[model samples]
Target: MLCFGFTFLYVPMVLLIVYSFNYSKIVPVWGGWSTRWYTVLFESEEVWAAITLSLKIALMNATFATMLGALAGLALVRFKSFRGRTLFGGMISAPLVMPEVITGLSLLLLFITLGQLIGWPTNRGITTITIAHITFSMAYVAVIIQSRLTGLDQSLEEAAEDLGAKPFRVLIDITLPLLAPGLLAGWLLAFTLSIDDLVIASFVSGPGANTLPMLIYSRVRLGLRPDINAMATIIIIVVAIGVCLAGWLMMRQERQRQRDMQLASGDNIKQD
Candidate 1:
């Protein structure tokens, strides 16, 4: 059942990729295969501009979301008994559960209100889209980091303190190293979400704020374009490669940690 489910989900994407090289723009048809569409995609300045904008927003959103989420995760995990903790956690995660349309509308209203009151974010553009992306992205990031924090060995932190390391130094040297994998995972997820966003971005984005997805959406609505297929194929390949790389890195890190533990145990036995 699980395999069937996975296959069902991926088959359409696989078909799309296969059809990307098809010479017939009508799709699901075979004409003599050609890479011409990819060539066109590379040469299109408009497409390139959208891609650049998306990448920039994704990078910035990921950085800010990851940092904010990490701090929130720490607070939630380490200080569970704080006043209004429940309300705070609920507020942090509200965006994730809210409908995209609702979230977008709310953000737009907030932007309007802020503009009238404070004169910031004067008009929607990259900043508005990025803020919306970060709003949701950070919720997922916080959840990931909090899960990792919950599973971490608290004794390691205590040992750092016993060794005369200050609290901040212990956090930097001990906690941060152990949490590196979680942070990296959270950052990657946040980046991917930001890059692929559409609905919220659509509502928040103003004139001249089209992202790659928005550009694609506009072109797709007109009719099938071979260039779109080529772009989709490239994105699928890139996403697959990234997933494989992340899995490999995580496995390698886990193996190294286990080996270190074994070596430490061996040294302790020898000293005894």
Candidate 2:
């Protein structure tokens, strides 16, 4: 089953990567294996511009989403009896459950209204796309952070408070550090979502603010091309490398944690 699943998932990608090097302009008709498409892809200014814009929006969206999501998670977890807590929590979770089309439509309407009411965001482009990405991305981040917080030992935070540490100090010294893995995961997820987005970005973006996904989508509609295949292959390679790197770091952190636990156990045994 696992092998079947893997084959089902990866066979198309494998084919895409193989055909990316095809000498022929037609995607299905493989003339011969060549690096011609890769060269063409590299030289394309429009593709490069879209890539640059996507990266910029993803970075901005990820950073802001992580920060805001962290704060929201902390509020939901720490402040147990706050007024309107239910309403706040519902609002935070809304984006996660909302359909992309509906979310995009609502945001588009919102931007139009805001533009008419106040002279802000006169034109929708990078700024609007980033904000739209952040809106949905932070919901995912908040869920990740909230789950991480729920699993954490509250005693450590309380101990810090008892030892004359201020609340902010406790958060800085204890809470945030413990939440590092979650924060990193959330940031990466947000970044990936922002870069991968198409529907929402399309609704919010202006004439010149085409993201890589939007550009790829537009090209696909025209017909498959070798350059597009090469672009996909490059993206696949980059994403695979990032995933492997993140996995390695996580494994290293887990090993270090296990070693610390062993040492702590040894020390306790000696004291006893």
- Candidate number achieving the greatest lDDT relative to the actual structure: 2
Query: How far does residue 112 in candidate 1 sit from its true spot (Å)?
Result: 1.8
Instruction: Put down candidate 1 lDDT per residue, 1-272, tens digits, no spaces.
Output: 99999999999898888888888767656887888889989999999999999999999999999999999999898786999999988888887789999999999999989999999888899999999899999999999999999999899999999999999999999999999989998999999999988999999999988999999999999987889999999999998998898789889999999999999999999999
* Residue-pair clash count for candidate 1: 0
List the lowest-lDDT window of 10 residues for candidate 2. Answer: 112-121
Candidate 2 lDDT, 113-201, residue by residue in tens:
99999977899999999999999999999999999999999999999999999999999999999999999999999999999999999
Cα distance off (Å), candidate 1, residue 192? 1.4
- What TM-score does model 1 achieve against the real structure? 0.89
Candidate-wise lDDT, in order: 0.92, 0.95
RMSD of 1: 2.6
What's the CA RMSD for each of the models?
2.6, 1.6
Per-prediction TM-score: 0.89, 0.95
Candidate 1 — which pairs collide?
Answer: none
